[model samples]
Target: MDESRPTPATPPAVLADHAERMEKLLDRLLSPQTLCDEIARPERLRAAMAHGLLGGGKRLRPFLVEQSAALFHANTDAVLRVGAALECVHCYSLIHDDLPAMDDDDLRRGRPTVHRAFDEATAILAGDALLTLAFDIVSSDETDLPPTRKLALVAGLSRAAGIGGMVGGQMRDLEAEKTDRPLAIRDIEMLQSMKTGALLRYACEAGAIAAGASGDERARLRRFGEIVGLSFQLADDLLDLTSDTATTGKATGKDAAANKATLPSLHGIDWTTARLRDLVVEATDLLDPFGSKADILVQTARYIAFRDR
Candidate 1:
């Protein structure tokens, strides 16, 4: 080990601190007072939006954005704004995913889902509002990035969240449920990459884009993001099979209940566990060139793969 390299240990407290800061940032961003002119802000709509957007999670996507940007020495405030925008998109997906017409979930992050807490129509509108708000946040003056960088961020996020990405993947998932035939491993991988991996890949790439990193550096983080994304979904499937709603703060075993063909369901727990470990190794190795500056991300990869919830 080089004497100048920073220690590799990244305590859980570091992640906790990041989460705490993200929570405050999200709260401020979602607040009605920060949204629009008093006359334009609707109370009920804002309330519904708050119910979903303010709901708690680990804020891992935003953390990825911020941390990845730090690698290239991007502006902190601009990076955080981009992170917040990404989070809005994530929250929107969760809200819509929980609706009756979709996964029909009733709980999320330990409370009533937006539809159950409010109404289905309101929930739908809230999700739409959040999705649009994300673009606004990125394009608006508050983000403080150059026009070119903002444009790049906007385009990247659109592709990640749009029909060819998360939306398309979701459609594939739903279509798969309707058919009796099980998905091939390659098909499953592609669907998972689109549905869950796109945003994550973009999160790291966004950092590089924000900092004007070379194409090689951007590609490196993009690969890292892809590895982390796979590990994230695999771990989630494992938790769904092994953990309960009390532990996960949401419905458990839904994949099995829905007869969804997750990798764990097909390949079994032992295989999934080993795969996750391998993915973490691959992700960390991709960051080795960054030295100790990548330690937090290495820790993040482990946390994503092995987190209990």
Candidate 2:
């Protein structure tokens, strides 16, 4: 079912002003070739890696990182590396999620999935490479952050992407797939939080942490992350139901066929839509402490739920 075009709720004017700064930062950080063509076998793997990683994603996670870093008055050049590093991890997850043994997706951000574009084995290794490469980028000397701050960001990302976070949630989702079990709304929330929200939270929090934010600021940022994170996942669920393959760049209605647990599956579309609105509102409220600095984050949260593609 195609939903009507969503309103283009732009990010706050403050954030909009820094769009060029963030773009420059992203360009600088991600400019390096991920492929080290020095070795022959690694070259082939790098090609597959580039194919998946270079695709045009919404770049939402990186945007969160850049915006959060800006809150602490962090230098754009110094903090943009964190954004690039987060993209590496996000790309890795998508590669794995599109694997044959996983979602078995033939398409990603409007192109063939890594496995389909390349081969299954290459796709698996490409994901592994990106995953490890993210840590390398964060911990590298080129990061331009203080040693202590860099270490904290690295540890936080490790925890968020490892067994305690995304991986654990994936296990829960896979187990739920073969069972006759029914999940409560709270349980569904937890699952989505861990599966999708973990990295997003990390993206926001780590940016603030890297910028040497105050304890109060970090606490507020965490709350903001939670709300926006949930909103992001809910938006994804809504898109699966309402977006077409042409716009989404992936097969529509995969969740229904896979019997995946989603907000719309647990509750009707109306309820899910209402819940998304509430989440976005709550997310926007969390940004009040940051004053005008958080306008972009707040507006972006509302845009997530309202976006159709």
Off by over 4 Å in 1: 1-11, 243-251
lDDT of 2 by residue, 188-245 (tens): 8888888888988888897789889987877778777877788788777878987789
Sliding window of 10 residues with minimal summed lDDT for model 2: 28-37
What tens digits encode model 1's per-residue C-alpha lDDT throughout 158-239? 9999999998988988888789988998899999999999999998888888888888998998899989899889888988
In candidate 2, how many Å is residue 252 off?
3.6
Q: Highest lDDT: which candidate?
A: 1
Q: What is the TM-score of each candidate against the true structure?
A: 0.92, 0.86
Predicted model with the maximum TM-score: 1
Off by more than 4 A, model 2: 1-41, 242-250
Please report how far candidate 2 places residue 258 from its true position, in Å. Answer: 3.0
